[model samples]
Target: MGRFIALMILVIPAVIAGYGIKLMRDTIFTLLNTPYPNLSVQFIAGFILFLAGLGFIGGFIFHRDKKNGKIAPRFKRRK
Candidate 1:
């Protein structure tokens, strides 16, 4: 099924990215000599990156109510 394959393709990367970020955060912070004490920064960075990846993947797989030609509005106008 085309839909199923597309859905899988989109989701699998997100899942892997999430897990990979977690692993990286733990490994990086678990060391003794490091500027970052806790993993808050790493966690947040990973979170943002993961969300970005999801957005990119979802742009195609997720459907939006489209009539003719329309575009989604940006959250904030660029200066």
Candidate 2:
């Protein structure tokens, strides 16, 4: 149950990241999405979304690694 919940939480960010990629690609191909007024807006929004999702996932993994002492010694909390 715990693992399932964790997976569900992760899925949302993954989907958001995927959609961001799609939006960026569309902008590059000159395909306009109605919700966005222009290519610049779409591209910017996509970039932000992609970074946000990536940051969240990266932070989660980093936290887990820190807890398990799997990361570099320099990153570990100092006593």
Candidate 3:
């Protein structure tokens, strides 16, 4: 049961990560086609999304245990 839960947790985010990658790919392509000087705000937003997507996907792969198959997110310290 624990293994099953772990697998499910991993799979759900894996699917979401796949979607994020696709969405970023398409958005980047679109942005490239647009005129220069896309709003700084726009660039910032895109960069944040791109970074976050990569982090989640990368962390997921790195944290996965092939035996039990769980994806664990890094712990955050709140001040």
Q: Largest TM-score belongs to which candidate?
A: 2
TM-score between candidate 3 and the true structure? 0.40
Candidate 2's displacement at residue 43, Å, is 0.2
Sort by TM-score, best first.
2, 3, 1
Candidate 1 regions exceeding 4 Å error are 28-70, 73-79
Worst window of 10 by summed lDDT in candidate 3 = 69-78
Better-scoring candidate (lDDT), 2 or 3: 2
Q: In candidate 2, which residue ranges exceed 4 Å CA deviation? A: none
Task: Give all TM-scores, in the order shown.
Answer: 0.40, 0.94, 0.40
- Full candidate order by lDDT, most accurate first: 2, 1, 3
1-79, model 2: which lDDT tens digit per residue? 9999889878888888888999999999999999999999999999988998888888888998888889998998799
Cα lDDT of model 1 by residue, 1-79, tens digit: 9989878877887886776476456757763225445566556556676777777666654343233235455532358
**Which pairs clash (backbone N, Cα, C closer than 3 Å) in model 1?**
none
Task: Give the candidate number with the greatest lDDT.
Answer: 2
Query: What lDDT tens digits, residue by residue, belong to model 3 across residues 1-79?
Result: 9989868866776665565455556566665324324544445555565566667766766655533545344433246
lDDT of 1: 0.61
Pairs in steric clash, model 3: none
How much is 61 displaced in model 3, in angstroms?
7.7
Model 3 regions more than 4 Å off: 31-79
